[model samples]
Structures are given as C-alpha cells and as structure tokens.
Target: MRWTWIDRFVRLEPGRRATAVKNLSWAEDYFADHFPGYPVMPAPLILEGLAQTGGILVGHVHQYRKNVILAKMTARFHAEAHPGQQITYTVELLDLNEAGARVRGTATVHDKLLAEADIMFAHVGPEQLPAELADPQFVFSGELAHLLRQAESVISASSSSPPSAVTS
Candidate 1:
C-alpha cells in the first residue's frame, strides 16, 4: 500500500520551495503499536513527511519526467508530536543540478518547531535502472501523481478566490 505522509499541499513553487500539512489522529495505525497510551508520532514518519514535501517540489521542477528519490537526510527533533496536532512542513530548495537536488526543511506545530532536516534527492534516469525496473513513471505514479494535481487545484482555488478582509 502506498502511504502519503502529507495531507495536502498549501504552497508549491517549482525549483524553489513547498509547504504541506499533515493532521495527526488517534485512528492512525502506528499509534496503536507505538507506545499505546502515550501515542507519539514516529520520528521517521515525520522525516518522511519532510522528504515527501521536498521531493514533490523537486519533481515539479522537471514536470515529473524524472524519478526523484530520497537519497540522504539529516534531521534533528526538538519535541514530540502527538495525535490531534497538525504538522506543517516547509521545504526550500538549497541546490539542484542534473545529479540531484538538496532541500532544507522544517516541521512545526502551531508555530513551534518540532523538527528540522536537510534532505537530498537523487534524480534517476531510465537508463540508470535495470530494464525490468525502467518504468518512466515508477516514482510519481498513482497516489503520488495525484498529489501534484491536488496541489495545483489548491493553488488555483486560492488564486481565484478574493482575499478576506482584515479586522482589528
């Protein structure tokens, strides 16, 4: 099964940055096995969210023609995130080239920092893979591809809507 770590993309800027969110819930399967009563979101999952956010940003740069794979990541967690909290992941492109791309990301809950990471994604070409695994759409197929469409819709909707009036 394909698991999407992010709920939705709030902002996406090709070759620049991306922002996405995930709402934690008690119903998540991991909570049942991860410490039972004191359900805390796994650190790896949090990192995955960041990577997904960054990965999408990198993929969008090439219009998803290239396979963007998470090659390396270094992260630090400052606090635990629990069910009912919302995690906001923001990633900025630090560097990008034919080889790959690097992103600096952060996860925050209600404006408080939860984790930060530096993630690297490798762009794999069809020729680099074995013939059996040389599907051009291998990485960005199905759910992951759907996410890009969803992000575009969100961006369109927000752009078309009138801005809300500010109140003192």
Candidate 2:
C-alpha cells in the first residue's frame, strides 16, 4: 500500500509556496504500537508528511520531470500531536535545479507550531531514466485523481466567498 500522509492541499502557489494538511486519526495502525496506551505520533513520520507536501509542490515546479527524494532535513519538534489533531504543513520553495529542490516548511496545529524543517530533495538516479520512472506520480493516475480532488477542494474553498444571509 502506498501511503499518502497528507490529506488535502490547503494552498499551492506554484513555485512560491504550498500548504497541505494531515488529519491524524485514532484508527491508524501505528498508533496501537507507537506508545501503547499513550499514542503519540512519531517525529519522523510527522516530518515525512511534511516532506510529501514539499515534494508535491516541488514536483509541480518541475512539471514532474525528475524524482524528488528527500536528501536532508533539519527538523525540530516543538509539541506532541495526538490522534485528533489536524496538522498543517506549509512549505516554501527555497531553490530548485536539475540536481533537486530545497524547501523550508513548518507543521502546525491551528496556531501552534508543532515542527519546522528545512528539507532538501535530490534526484535519485542516472539522467537517462524515462519520465514515468523518474517522476512517479504519472504511474498512479487513478489514485492521484482522488487526492487531487481533495486538494482542489481546499484551493477552491479558499477563493470562494462565504454564504450570505438572506433576510427576506
């Protein structure tokens, strides 16, 4: 099973920045073993979710040309996240090249910063691989469509106006 940590794309600003969310649920398998009775989300896993958000944004910048693999990270965790928290990861593009991309991001629960990191993504293999292999999103169009729908909803909702009260 291919695990997608982020649930929705709250914002995507092309080459500038992006924001995505992960809704932690009690039903997750890892929670049962993570801390026994006190289920706390692992720090590395939280960072992975953030990386996925950044990776997707970076892929958009490249139009899915090269593989975006995590090269390095300097992540600091400030708070523990429980099962019911919705973690929002906001990533800003620092730099990009054929070599890879550099992104800085922060994961937050509402207004509280849970974690922050500067992550680097690098191209994994030789220069000759086909785009299908180099950039993997194309291989799973059906699954990505569902994710895209969730993401698009967030983007559309942000630009939409609230319902007006009709006093008739």
Candidate 3:
C-alpha cells in the first residue's frame, strides 16, 4: 500500500533539503485502538513521516527517475505526540550519488525536538527497478504531482521539471 504520512511541504530546496508538516487529528483512523484512553501517534508512523520528507528531497535530485526507497534508519524518539499536535518534519540531504543518498532529519513540535534520524536510501533508477515498478514515472506519478503542485504554489522554483510531464 502506498501511504503518504506527511501532509504538505512547508519548504523544499532541491538537492538540499525539505520540510513538511503533518497535523494530527482525533479523526485519524488508527486512534481508535492505538491506546484507547491515551491516544498517541505511533512511533513507526512518525519515522515513516520523516522518511517521506527525505524521500521527496532525494526524488527531486533524481528528477523523478528513481525510486528512493529507505534502506536504513537510526531513529530516536524523545516524546509522544497527541492527536492535536502538528509535527514539522525537516530532512536534509547529507550526500548523493548514482547509487543512493544519505539524509538526517528531525520531527519537531513547537521548537522542541520530538524525534530524529539518520536515513539511508537506495536510488533504484528506472532501469534497475523491478518489473512491477519498471515504469518509474507512473510509479511515483501521483505523489510527484501532489508534491509538484505544492512546490510550484509555494516556492516557484522554475528550474525543476513540472509534474505534467508524466501522463496518467
């Protein structure tokens, strides 16, 4: 299943970094059983949120030609987030190459850090992808479209390619 945990991009610097936000709501599906009386966002989901932010940064570098999958992560959680909290996830690219890239990120509420991680990704280009994902463009078309719309509306980074290049 393809699930994008981060809600929207607050900032996106191509090949450098990105910051996204996720406003937790009481209506979220998982809250019903996550703790019953003491509802809190799951740690794993938070990690995924951070990973998605880094993924978008890496994707911008590859020109949407690769599937930047999470290969490794060393994450630390310092606090729990309730439904009403809004998390700002910040991800910075540390290095990039034909093979993949490395990133460091943090999820924060207010000015305090709630969690952080150093994540590694494998940049599987179109030629290297499995048959199910051979069409790299379509594989990420939906996400790229949403992100592209967000990016164009916010920063007007005209140097980047438009999402419409990919057909439905």
Q: Could you say which candidate leads in lDDT?
A: 1
lDDT of 2 by residue, 1-168 (tens): 757788889787666678998999989998999999999999998999899888877766545555667889999989999999999999988887667778999999999999999999886554445666744444225455576555545543342332232101
Q: CA lDDT of each candidate?
A: 0.86, 0.77, 0.81
Give the C-alpha miss distance for residue 138 in model 2, angstroms.
7.5
Off by over 4 Å in 1: 155-168
lDDT of 3 at 166: 24
- Residue-level error in angstroms, candidate 1, position 88: 0.2
When 1 and 2 are scored with lDDT, the better candidate is 1
Q: Sort by lDDT, best first.
A: 1, 3, 2
Query: After aligning candidate 2 to the native by TM-score, how far in Å is the CA of 161 from where it should be?
Result: 23
Clashes of 1: 0
Clash counts per candidate, in order, are 0, 0, 0
lDDT of 1 by residue, 61-131 (tens): 77889899999999999999999999999998888888898999999998999999999899999878888
Candidate 2: clashing residue pairs, number: 0
**Predicted candidate 1, C-alpha RMSD:** 7.0
Best-first order by TM-score: 1, 3, 2
Clashing pairs in 2: none
State the TM-score for model 3: 0.85
TM-scores of all candidate predictions against the true structure: 0.89, 0.79, 0.85
lDDT of 3 by residue, 10-39 (tens): 888676678899999999888888989889
